[model samples]
Target: MSGAVPLNDPRFQTDPVELYRELRRDHGAVAPILLDGDIPAWLVIGYRELHQVTGDPALYSRDSVLWNQWDNVPDDWPLLPMIGRGETSIIHTTNGQHRERAAMISDALEAVDPFTLRQHAERLADELIDSFCADGRTDIIGRYTMLLPVRVLARLLGFTDEQGPGLVTALNEMLDGGEDALTGHGHLVEAATALLTEKADGPGADVVSRMLANRGDFTVEEITKDLLMIMVAGHQPTADWIGNTLRLMLTDDRFAASLSGGRHSVGEAMTEVLWEDTPTQNVPGRWATRDTNLGNRRIRAGDLLILGVAAANFDPQIRTDSSVLTGGNTAFFSFGHGEHRCPFPAQEIAEVIARTGIEVLLDRLPDIDLAVPGEALAQRPSPWLRGLTSLPVIFSPAPALSPARRP
Candidate 1:
């Protein structure tokens, strides 16, 4: 632990893949690290190591209450929002209770009509494009990618369209792990509470209503917390997936054919992004339930283990040919792995939203190209999630599609 790295090091925000390589070389799979405020923890960067950690729920638990550093953590710590404790949400639950909660969530999400989901995605994408189509130039991140997922998700979750913007603001601020994180969390809780109250009297054909109808015997507070979990888990990562995939399609020559009309490669580009530039870079994390060994590091009971998702994807042991395209290879840890991995239904929903949004953008603006050099593009400054701050692009001006013409 002599050269323990700080997780908040600026290098992690910019060019993290290289930093991951350095960490892997210097510390092997499990490296001693410091979270914000110099609190010690371990980062599991090896692909095999990460798989083992996530697969064994009994050994490496999701229950943050088991963390040994809580006593030293200040009440005002900015990271408290990201590393929450004593929450009754599905993310913190274990054993039989966790299974019940997970079943409720999966059932609700699985019931989403696939055709309607695509329709919502396409219509929302078209509406966003209509806002900027006449200008011939726009920052796709701020104007489109960042807004579309939350808007589409809001509609599916029974929130009014007017509520979408505020939700986006709060979700981003909370996920950014900054000074306003706690405040952002407060806004989300307030919004969820109000929405659940409204849904109680009158259920609808939405995820929230469906969860309410589930026979889980969940209380208002429990459902509200789970709703917040779903919103936070569903929004930003999907947005980043669209952004990263679009960036890949624009910058990489392999996908250049799609920019001109060959849309067949869109799925391939998206899959590649999962292996290369996943949205959820580093997840926080599994706590060691007892003394154990991982990747040559001795982990003590209650030790924090941060999942190095992006790092594991780049692990040389598994990725023997780093230069080779990851065509159809879905083994990457982006959506996570094992028992607590993202639900299959939720994964399907994210894919529909992202893939539909990308396809709609390409169909609407076939000639779009990056306005700035690809190297000039910068990433958002957060170690936990990886995405662009903005993706400026230009295309020939076109008239907006009339409402009659919209599908």
Candidate 2:
């Protein structure tokens, strides 16, 4: 549990939730660490502590990156940066700026409404599953889970299917740190350029096109970057949630039975999966801007901070019982917390994935099971992310067992 593991190791490549559980049990909430000769920081793993840190912007700041502000200003900082001395986007902005941007974004999302999107989500879900139902088996991560959100996000942003593959690839590359030139907001800059140059008007009702049509409120630059932010933030978490939920069901049919039982069970199952295996395992890294108390620790300026959403979701202290993570309990850290919480678009997307997508998948596929035993499935290696790189499931078209005994 202590030694460094290769990123591509089978253990790391499969069962990310188990790895997170192992790490939390071994490391605790405020674990000490030294990484690559850099300043050591505490990785907060408990649910209560992670919630506290994320909610309080006064002590911990999300803008941890040290921009080069020598004689010349860093290219990253904006002319009228919203927070602190240098300008940054809402995600990295702290306190007031973060709240203001969140309000704007939330208002936009609310205006879209869940009732309207459900029909579209259902249609998309139908198309995606129809292609694979005949195969009798598939990798949920690659074919099913990853594909739909990108499409939904593209549709929401006004991008065409023609542009979906490239945009998704670019976003993943950015997340994996493959291209140094696109670090931080530079990634957003690159994505926006691609959309503007190629898909700006080709043909689609993506979020980008919507923003362009509603140009009165946002600047071209702001529209471009915010769309990029949605692309980057929206797809992965939803994709991972869908994929991980399938993984959970394949491993335990009881959970699947419960989900398939009715509408209420579907919502309960989604919450349970989030608590058991949250899609976003690691919170964005925060830095202490000034000396402050987090729980009992004395955190000082420049000290790196990590809120372990995965760990916190499973915290026995808050959960009161571990099984609650996989089956019960209502409150959770699935979408994150407070100022740095995930955009509320997350709730609708999650509900869609849970009730519509997952329920239908389970109903259509019978006797489905993991290709590898649950223990053998691989996990993504990063401590900051929780997801399966691949989930191979065997599927068959058959009616579920009697409803009375199911679940």
**Candidate whose lDDT is highest:** 1
Please give, for residues 43-150, the per-residue lDDT of candidate 2 as tens digits.
677777887788777667777463222224343432212122333556776666566666666555555656646655656666666677677777877777777777
Per residue, candidate 1 scores C-alpha lDDT tens digits across 1-407 of 57999887878767787898899889999988998888999999999999999999999999999999998899888788778876778888888888999999999999999899999888888999999999999999999999999998998899999999999999988888888888999999999999998988899899999999994677989999999988988999999999999999999998999888668999999999999999998898889999998988889999999999999999999998877898789999999898888999999999999999999999998999999999988888776888899999999999999997787
Question: What TM-score fits each model?
Answer: 0.98, 0.78
Cα TM-score of candidate 2: 0.78
Best by TM-score: 1
**For model 1, the run of ten residues with the poorest summed lDDT:** 79-88
